[model samples]
Target: MSTAPVFAGPDAAVPRHVAIIMDGNGRWAKRRLLPRAAGHRAGVEAVRRVTRAARALGIEALTLYAFSSENWRRPAEEIGDLMGLLRLFIRSDLAEFQRENVRLRILGDYRRFPTDVVTLIDDALARTAANTGPSLAIALNYGAQAELTRAARRLAERLPPEQIDEAAIEGELETRELPPLDLLIRTSGEHRLSNFLLWQAAYAELLFVDTLWPDFGADELSAAVADFGQRQRRFGGL
Candidate 1:
């Protein structure tokens, strides 16, 4: 692996932490005349591919928006399919993750899932807890607004208003365990945050790509990272 700084610097070639909104699985399925479930399955494959690519590229952390809190509003059947897919992914990939030294982390309140799903997630988290490789954070049942609200409540309960500053609130966030977000990518040509990492993205570079989640792979990821390298990030300065 390349020995490069994960944090922002004048010569940083790869982001230390990268977050992705894996969007358009359903649309990809519709375009192919396949069930949305199939698209999601393919999306899982993409996840595997991208995880390996990120690790190979020397990224320290990768965050994926797998499922949102609002996803509960989706149809029950679709939700069930997604849940099943999650179980399958964890069961099939846990060993590989361990072998690759990937640390699995959940960014949202995953306990709200079905008992079995929750059990599987907890098992995965524990099993990979000791790994020192790249961190992979899956955002299941996550929402940026909700995260911020919960962080605020936690701070309010522990500290007075005067002491509740940015650092305190960020320390309360789930992402505090992960690296500072350096690059955020949204796929399927969408150009929105979609309630993800609002606080951590304060100075992170944003990239929108037309590739659907399932179609995303190493090449696309490398291209995006290359594009990111070419841009001059002033971080709101001249």
Candidate 2:
């Protein structure tokens, strides 16, 4: 029996849109008898690795669930650490993005983030907008229910009772411009959406791995893609 997953397989097709549920940093730290902040720092490294790998593989779009609105419930210190890491990543990754021609975008409620952090995000996005490479979207303070509700409210405020249709609702969605998800992977083995890109990932092939975010690397991502290549996407019917 093959114990390790194959990184490249002829059966696997490259995904155009891939979303990741980055989970299990805390658990990973606890297991090592290290501080939770350590795990978070390690997870950030994993993010860099996966992004580079995806770009190298010529993936069109990569979306990461960085921080959800519910994450505010965590300790203030941890939040601070996360925000610090985010800031560092943005400042340092800009050159890498320019080199790779990658366009960086933040997907979520900007109002909920700190003013300074929001400013940094905006600047980073603007600077990379013209890049002709892969689009890397980071979800911060995002909630699927909140996104859907906001979309619906916008529609209600703009139109009366005559133009309600699937296309209308979809047009109102935040992810209207992005392609439908081809694969959704969750690290740390928790098989739940946790309120991610609910509308977009409707029929995406899901892969749940036992590895934690900190442990996930280029090899792990490649293996997931290899698995994706083996599956025949039927959408609804075979």
CA RMSD per model (angstroms): 3.1, 5.7
Taking all chains together, each candidate's TM-score versus the true structure is 0.94, 0.92
Q: For each candidate, what is the lDDT?
A: 0.90, 0.86
Q: Pick the candidate with the highest TM-score.
A: 1
Error of 2 at 27 (Å): 1.2
* Candidate number achieving the greatest lDDT relative to the actual structure: 1
Off by over 4 Å in 1: 1-11
Give the per-residue lDDT digits (tens) of candidate 2, residues 1-238.
0012223345666988889999989999999999999999999999999999998787888999999989999999999999899889999888999889998877788667777888888898899999987889889999889998998899899888688776787787766666667889999999999999887777778999999999998899889988888887765654
Q: Which pairs of residues collide in candidate 2?
A: 11-229, 12-229, 13-229
lDDT of 1 by residue, 1-238 (tens): 1122334444557878899999999999999999999999999999999999998899999999999999999999999999999999999999999999999999999999999999999999999999998999999999999999998998899889999887788788998888888899999999999999999988889999999999999999988888777777766666
